[model samples]
Target: MMDVLIETRGLTRNYGEICALKPLDLRVNNGEWLSIMGHSGSGKSTLLNLLGGLDRPSDGFIRVGGEDLRVLSEDGMARYRREFVGIIFQQHHLIPYLTAVENIMMAQYFHSVPDEAEARTALERVGLGHRLKNRPGELSGGEQQRVCIARAIINSPRLLLGDEPTGNLDHGSTRVVMELLSELRAEEQFTIIMVTHNHEVAAWGDRTIYLDDGVMVREELKGD
Candidate 1:
């Protein structure tokens, strides 16, 4: 049986009077690729932020890889984010002044020690070895995203969270990025939770769940 890697019980978040996410109970099995689909304001990003330890829930609990986020201190949560979770945003989030390899090394720096060789290897893994010295502006959109992927995985995080990771790419680039993610997942066995509005992108996962108005309204396993 697949072990539960992430679980949330009555997980909720509020922005003053606005409830961004309703009380939610969810579980994600280890090594599973789970896709989240929702319209704007459906709380997908909110949930991702909560799971990644970037934001705290106003109520309830989140447990991932044996750590209870509710019980963790601010520093503890930061450690969890650095050591356990990798996040990719629609924007590549690379520093404009940094080269591709340097951008990846930055993530390593935050995690612990930065090793240029390790950073170069990560860039190579993402097919950016030749562009190591290129800044984000000097690379194509697809290449920039590849650099982001390398940076995200440099720490070998157990959980990878993607928020519309391909939203900024064209169809071909989208396919390339998704395929690369699949390849990485196959080799690394890291659990992936991706949020996207695109059905085709959601199809890349093992299962897909749809959120509507902050509620999980539908869920489908692959081949169902």
Candidate 2:
């Protein structure tokens, strides 16, 4: 039997009077790679935030791994983000002064305790073993993103969320990042929900859903 890791019903989100996401339902199976694609102002990031528990829905239900997100308190949501979700954004968001390994260790510091050994392992897993001591300013865009990936997986989260993770990368860099993510997902068995405007990036996932004006207009199976 297939395991359902995330489910939403009539999910909606609004900012002031603007509806960012309309009433919709979504289901994501365990370990599935689901991509969300849309043009600007199409609610792609809003949906990703809601799923990551970084933002709450204005109405309806959202459940991940059997936990209903709507009912979580602020602290509860923080805990959920720390323990269950790992996120990567278009911006590296690294401390300019911190070394690659330190940046990853910082993520660990928030989750529980910072462990240098584990942080090093995470960086190594992302193929950054040789660049551990380099600060964000010293690394290339792709290398900086690799550090972010290491930091994201350092917590061993059950779900990974990416908001235009490869948006700033060149074609070669994007390929490297996506390939690394695929390998990491296979080893960790985590579900991935990524938002991207690029069709090539969306095609990396098993399925892609397209949103328009806050509504899901259509979806396509990867190989169909």
Of the candidates shown, which would achieve the greatest lDDT relative to the real structure?
2
Tens-place lDDT digits, model 2, residues 47-158: 9999999999999999999999999999999999999999998998999989999999899999999999999999999999999999999999999999999999999999
Per-residue accuracy of model 1 over 90-192 as CA lDDT, tens digit each: 9988999999999998999999999999999998988888999999999998999899888889999999999999999999999999999999999999999
- The TM-score that candidate 1 achieves is 0.98
Cα RMSDs of all predictions?
A: 0.7, 0.8
The global C-alpha lDDT for each of the candidates, from Candidate 1 onward, is: 0.94, 0.95
Which ten residues in a row are the worst by lDDT in model 2? 89-98
